[model samples]
Target: MPLDEPAALAEGSSRLPTLEFALTGSTADYLIHASPDLLSKARAFEHWESTRLAHGLLPFARSLQTPPAAHTTLREQDGRDVRGLNFSSQDYLALSSHPAVVAAAQEAMARFGVHSAGSSVLAGNVGDGVALEQALADFLGLPHVLLFPTGWAAGFGVIKGLVRPDDHVVMDVLAHNCLQTGARAATRHVHLHRHLDVDHARRLLTRIRRNDPHNGIMLITEGCFSMDADSPDLAALQALAQEFQALLVVDVAHDLGAMGPNGQGQIGLQGLHGQIDVVIGAFSKSFASNGGFVAGRSRALKEYLRYFAATATFSNALSPLQIAVIHQSLKIVRSVEGEWRREQLMQAVQALRQALTQEGLTVWGQASPIVPVLLGDERRARLAVREMGQRHLLANLVEFPAVPRHRARLRMQVMSSHTAEDAQQAAATVAAALAASAQLMPQAAQTP
Candidate 1:
C-alpha cells in the first residue's frame, strides 16, 4: 500500500507501465498533505493500493494529457500536433471556440476581473451571474435555477442538500459518479436498478414505498447515459415517480444542449418539460462553458439549495467570463443557428454510427451525439485506442469499472463542427484500428 509497491508489484510485465510519483514515501508519510489525520493517510494509501493493479495494467487511459481544442481535431498525447478527429471532448455543439462566445468572454473579462474571488453566497455573486441564472431558468422554462462551479457539483450538491439520511434514493446503476457519491453520502438507503430498466425501477420503488411510505424518496437518473449513450424511458420513469410519490432528478448534462428542438434535450424530446420535479444539467457539454445549474418549479427550492448545498455555498461561483460565455452560448443554442448545429451534430453521429455498424461493430443507444462502439475485450479496447491515436483519430477508451468488465468500449462524441467527411474518416479509422488491435491482443486479459 505504499507508493513504491506498484512499481515493485508491476515488475517486468511489459504490459504494465510504471508510475512515478513525486512523493517518495507511503501515503501515511503525507498525512500533512491535506489533513493532519493518520486515518485519512491510511485510507488514502488503501485507495491507491486498490487501483494499483489497474494502474499497472492500463496506464494509458489515465496518462497525463491536454486537449487543445473543441473541434474534431486535437493534439496527440506525445506532444505532437495531429489532425486527428477528436471524439473525446464533451463539447457536443462545438460552441466553445465560436467567435461570438469568445468575444463575449473577452469583453466580460475586460469589464470584470477573471475570478469571482468569493463564494456565490457572498461577494462572488455578480450581476451578470444573476442574469445568467435567470436566462437559464427562462431557457429551461423552469421557475428557479441555482448555479454551481461544475456539473458534477450540481448533481452532488442537490442530493446532499435535499436528501436526509432517513430518505431513500433509487438511482440507475449507470448514473453519474457524482450522483452516486451524493446518494451514498446523503442517505442510508440507496437502491440501484439495472440501467434503463424502468420496470425494475418500478419494482424497487414499489418495495421501498411499501416499506417506508412516509419518508422522502428520490428517483435519480440522467437525461442521457454518458457511457452507454442510451436514454431511459423518461415518460415511464415519470409515471413511476408519480405512482410512488417520489421526486425525480434527471441530470441532462449530455443531451440538454445538443439534442431536441431548440436544444431542450431529453425532457423536451419526451414532451415532459416543466413536469419533472427537478432538472439538472451542465454547461460543459452543450453550453460550451464551465459550471452546472439545477432548476425546479419553486423559488423556495432554489433558495433552500443556495443555503444548504455545501458545494455551492462553500465554493466560488462561476467566473464573470464563464457566466458571460454561458449566457452567449445559451443565446446561440436557442437561435436558428443552434438548431442547424444540432442537425449537423446528429447527422455526424448517425453517419458514424452507421459506418461503424456497417463495419460489423456494435454501436449502442438511440440517436445522440455520443456513439459508443462496444469492445468487450479490455486488451483489444486499449490496443484500439492506441492504434486509433496512431492513425490520427482520438477516441476515448472506457473500460471497467466505468462499464462492466466485459463491456469495455470506445466512447466517441460527435461534434457539430465535424463534417460528413470527418465522420466517415473517423469511422474508417476506427474500423481499421479495431482490426489491427485484434491482431495485437491475441488473448484477452483474464478477469481480475
Candidate 2:
C-alpha cells in the first residue's frame, strides 16, 4: 500500500506525532504495526516480500551522512565515512555550491528571515518571490506563472485544479508519479500511451475527443523522463493537442534547468515556447533551489491557477531565501558560463554511457544525463549496488514498482562537476562490482 493511504492504525491510539520520526524494523513491520489491514490485503506482493527476505542474505542500504553533492562522502549505518565519487546527485549544473547563488540566499535570509509562514493566498509572497515568478515568465516567454512549494505538488495540484470528473487526461505511461497521482485524483477517465510514443498519444487523444468532444481533454507528458533519461517530441505533441482541441501540459522537472539552448529545456530545444499550452517545472534540479512553477500562455489562466490550484493556494509559497537562490541561479543559467557547464555535463554523460556499454551492460535510452544500467535480475541488481558501495562509488538502485522488476537498474546521474576521469573510473568500478555481484548471486541464493 502507498504510505499515504489510510492504514489500520491502532484504534484509540493517539495520532502519530507529526513532528516525530516513525521508525520500524522493516516494511512488513511498519505495515503490521501501522496498518495491519492494508498489509493483509497486500499479501499478493510476492516481489516485495522476496526482496525483503533477500536483504538479510546480502548487504544493502548504505547510509549517506551528507547532503547530495558531486563527490560527497557517504557513511555506513554505524557512522563510518565511505570515501567515494557520487553519481547519485541531480545537481547537473554544479550550481549548488556556486558562490553567487549561495550569497543571494544568505542575503535573502538576513533581510527577509527564513519561513514564509503563510500560504500565498494569505500573505506568503515574501521578498522577491513575485519578482522571481515574473522573471521566469519573461525567460520562458509565457504570459504568466504561478509557483508551488515542490515539483510534486505543482504537478499534482495543477491537474486536480484544472480538470473535472468528466474530463479526460491522456498521459504517457511513464509519466512521473506525481503527474499520475494528480490525473487520477482529478478525473476517472484517464488514458495512458506508451512512453514517448507520439503516435500512440495522438490516437488516444483522438479517440477521447471523439467521445467527449465538449469535455476538457489534457494531453500530458514530460520534457524529460527522469528514470529513462529520454525526451518526447514536444512539437509533435503540440500539433496533436492543437488538432484535438486539448491542452498540452509538459512537465519539464528533470530537464528544464539542465538541457537545451540557454537551458530553456525540451520545449526550447523544440522551439515550442509559445506553442505549448502549459509548462510545469521544478527549481530543484539545476537551479540550486526548492519549489516549482506552472507557466501558462495567458494571464487569465495563470490567475485562475493561483486561486484554484490547491497546492499553491493552500501550501506556503517559496521561502525568500529559496526565491533569491532561484533568482540568482536563473541569471547564471542564462549566461555563457551556464552553457559551458552544460557542455561539460554532456561530455561526462556520453563518456560514461560509452564506457558502461563496452562493459557488456545494457544501457537504457538516448542520452540527456540520466543513465540507467539495466541489471534485469533484482537479486543481482541489489548485490551490485552493495558491491559498488563497497568500492566507494555511490549511485541509486531503482527497483520493482519504480520500474518493472525485470528492468531493475542502477540510475546514475552525471553532473557538470564530474570530470572525464571521474566518469571513466566510476564506470570501471561499476562494471567490476556488477561482475563480483553476479559471481556471488548463486551462492547467495543457495545459502537460505
Candidate 3:
C-alpha cells in the first residue's frame, strides 16, 4: 500500500491520544498484558502501528524494488517507487553484485538445481556445502566450523547447543538479540554486563564463578555491535574469560570479511585472531549470501553443535547456490582484492562520518560501516523518517527497545561502492530531513 503523507490529526480525537501513545510509547510497554487472550493483547499495539502506518510515519517493512546496491529503488507502502542513494543494506564490501560471485551462483544453480533438500546432518551436505565449511574454517584459522541456515540461527544455536541448564551465561548488555535469546533459552543464570566494559564483565564472571563454581560459564560479546557501531576489547575479554575459567564467544557478523587487515575483523585487528575461543559470523553482511557459521578450535565441539543445535539439525541446509556464492565471496575476501575493498570501504566510512559531522549531526561509534546519527526523541525520529523518505535518503530508523528510550537514531550502513559524492548527498539529505522533522515537533505536541 502507498503511504500517504502525514497529516495533522484533529484535536481531541481518541486517536490523537493513541497517536501520542504510539509516538511516546515503546514495544516493551505492550509486550505484557493482563488479558488472558493471546490474540487480543496485541490490539492496542496494532492500533498504534496502524495509526503510524496510515500517516506514513512507520519506516519499516519497506520493499526494495531492485537489487540492493549503492543506489537503488524502493517501493513505498502505497506502491510508489522512490529512488535514492542506498545506505540501508548491510552489503559492507559491496560484493553482492560482483561478477565472479554472480557467476558462481549461476553455475551452482545449473549444477545443483535450487534447494539443498535436506538438513546438513541428513543428506544436505553437498560438495559445495562441504567445501564452503572447510573454506570458512581455513579463512578464520579455526580447524572446525559448522554452518547454519542464517546468522541468527548460528548465533542462537551455538549458545543453545552447548550450554546446558546448569550452565551460566555472562553477556554484554548490548549483545545481539539471538545471543540474548539463546542465553535465556539455555539457562536462567544470565548476567548482562555493561556495554564494552571489560572490567564490568570481569566482575560478573568473578561473581558467577564464586556462586556457581561447578557449572560452565559462557562469556559472550560482539566483534562489532550493529546498532551502536562499536566493538569490545577482544584481547581483554579473552583474558578475562580464561582467568575465570569461562569460554568466550565473539559474534563477528558485522565485521568479518569487511574490516581489519586480511579481513580478520576485530579479532585480527586486535591481534587476537586465532586465539579466540569461539567466533561466530554471518555471511549476509559481507559475503553476499544468506547463512551463518560457528568456528572453533575444537573438532569435538563442532561435531557436538552440528548434532545438538536445533536450528542446524532441524532447518534445511543452505542451498548449493548460496554455498557457491559464499565460496567465491570468501575467495575475494581473502585475496588482495579484498584488502583493496576494505580500504575503499574505510575511506567511504570516513567520508560519511566527516560529512555527517560537518552537517552538525551527532554520529556515534567508531569508524565502521554503521554510522548512527542520534535523533534522541521518538517523536522527532518518526518525523525524520518520514522526511527521509520524502528526501529520498534510504537509511534505517532505530528507536526505543532497540536502543535506550529517548535515544533513537538513524543507522546508515555504508558500502565500499558508496562514493564521496554519495556520502555528501546522504549527509545533506539527513541534515535537511532532521531540520524538517524538528520544525513540526511543536505542532505535533499541540495536536495530541
Candidate 4:
C-alpha cells in the first residue's frame, strides 16, 4: 500500500492530489498529498518508491477545501441508499433543518441575499451575528462571543491570538487538530499526557511552570472532544489553570447543544463559567448551523474582536441567517423538544455502549455521546466500513498521523435526533461486522 514519495504528481515536490474513492460508500475519502516541505518532499520521493498508498492524506470531511452540499449524503458501494441514517452527524437536535432555521435562512436571503452581500467590515456588522454571539456568550456563562467561519479557524485563533512567540501552550496529546496547527506559530510545549489523565496534565503544568515561570501558558482542550466523546474534567482543568496561573481555553464544539444542564455546553453545565478563561465552540455541531466562535469576559472578547482574531477581521462574517437560526436553535436546544431529543440520544448512547461492551468491543468514550470503536490497521479499518455500508450505517474511518499509526478507528458520534432503535441497529451491525472481520484483522478484534 506504500505510495510514491509524493513527487510523482504535479512536480515541485508537493505531493500530487491522490484520491481514494469510497470503496466502502462513506465520505471516508483519502487524499494524497505531496510533502508540505519541498526538500523533504523531494527526499521522500527519492527514498520511497512513489507508490499509491504511502502518500495518503487525512480523513475526507476535515479537508474543508470546499463547502459540503446543503444536504448531501454519499451513496454506498453496496448500492444501498443508506444515507438516511440518524447516526454519524453533528446535528444534535437536528436544528439545521428545523422549520424555524430554514425560515430564517430564507428570510436572510431575502434581506441580505445568499452571500454576506459584503464582508463584515464593508457589510456594516450584521445584527444577526452580533445577536448570536451575545446569546452564545450568555448561554455559556461567558460575557462575550466573537464568531468565525470554522471551528478550526477559531481554535487556531485562540492560541495564535493569545500566545506570543516566546509564550507556551501545553495541551492534551489528544487535543483537536486545530490547536496544534494554530500553536505551531508559537512555542508548542506540548505535553502528550496520557489521554484524559488529569493528573498527568497537572504534572505537565507544574513542570512547565517551574521551567518557564513568566511565559504566558495557555491550556487548550475540547470541552467534549469530537473524536473521544469524553468530557474533560473541567473542574480539574479549572483548578490546574488557576494553580499554574495559565489561561484556560476550552473548545466546546462537541459539547455545545449535547451537554450541560440544558445544553448551555459544558462550561455552563460545569458551573466554571467565570473560572475558565475562555470558551470556544462551533455552530455546526449540535446547533446544526455552520460557523465557530470564541467566548470570554466581555472585555476579553472585545479585545479579541478588536485585535485578537485575524479571521474575524479578514474572513467573511458568518451569514446572518446562520446567526439567527443558531440563536433560535440554542434557545430551544434545552427546551421541551430539546430535552426529549437529548434523552433519546442518551438512551441510544447507553444502549450502544453496553452492546459494544457486551460484544467485547473497545468503545473509547465514557459517557458523552461520542463513541470510538477501535480497529487499528488502516486498510482493514476502511474495509470494516465497507462492511458497515453493507448494513446501511455509516461509520467514520480515521487513520494515522491524524491518530497514532496503529490507532485507526471507526469514530461514531451520536445525534439527539437518533432513536434508541438507531443505536441498537448500528451496534448490531457493527458487532456482526467485527465478527466477520475478526479473522481478517489481528491488530485487536475485541474491545471493551
How do the predictions measure up, each by TM-score? 0.86, 0.87, 0.94, 0.81
Query: What C-alpha lDDT do the candidate models reach, one value each?
Result: 0.81, 0.80, 0.88, 0.67
Candidate achieving higher lDDT, 1 or 4: 1
lDDT of 1: 0.81
Worst 10 residues of 1 by lDDT: 17-26
- RMSD of every candidate to native, in Å, equals 5.4, 6.3, 3.9, 6.0
Best by lDDT: 3
User: Over the stretch 1-448, how does candidate 4's per-residue lDDT look in tens digits?
Assistant: 2333232543455554433321111211223335566565444433332232223222233221112222225543222244434355666666666787678778887887766754455563588777777777667667777777788778887778778878878777788888887887756555566777889888888888888888888888778877766777888987888899988888888877876677766776678755678878787777767788887876756565545567666678777777677777877785888777677767767887887877777888776777888876555565566566556666577776677666778787776656666776778888787666555543433331
Best by TM-score: 3
Clash totals in order? 1, 0, 5, 15
Please identify model 4 stretches exceeding 4 Å from their true place.
4-73, 76-86, 118-124, 439-448
lDDT score for candidate 3 against the true structure: 0.88
Better of 3 and 4 by TM-score: 3
Q: Write the per-residue lDDT of candidate 2 for residues 1-448, one digit (tens) a residue.
A: 3333223233344444221111101243334344446754354233333334344222235565665677787665445577789998888888888889989989998998988988988899874988998899988888788889998999999999999999999999999998999999999998999999999987888788777778999899999898898888888888888899889899999887688888988888888765688999998888888889999888888888888899999898898988998899999889999999999998999999999898888898877779888876666676677788779898887866678755778899989988888988988998999889767675434231
Global lDDT for candidate 2? 0.80
Ranking by TM-score: 3, 2, 1, 4
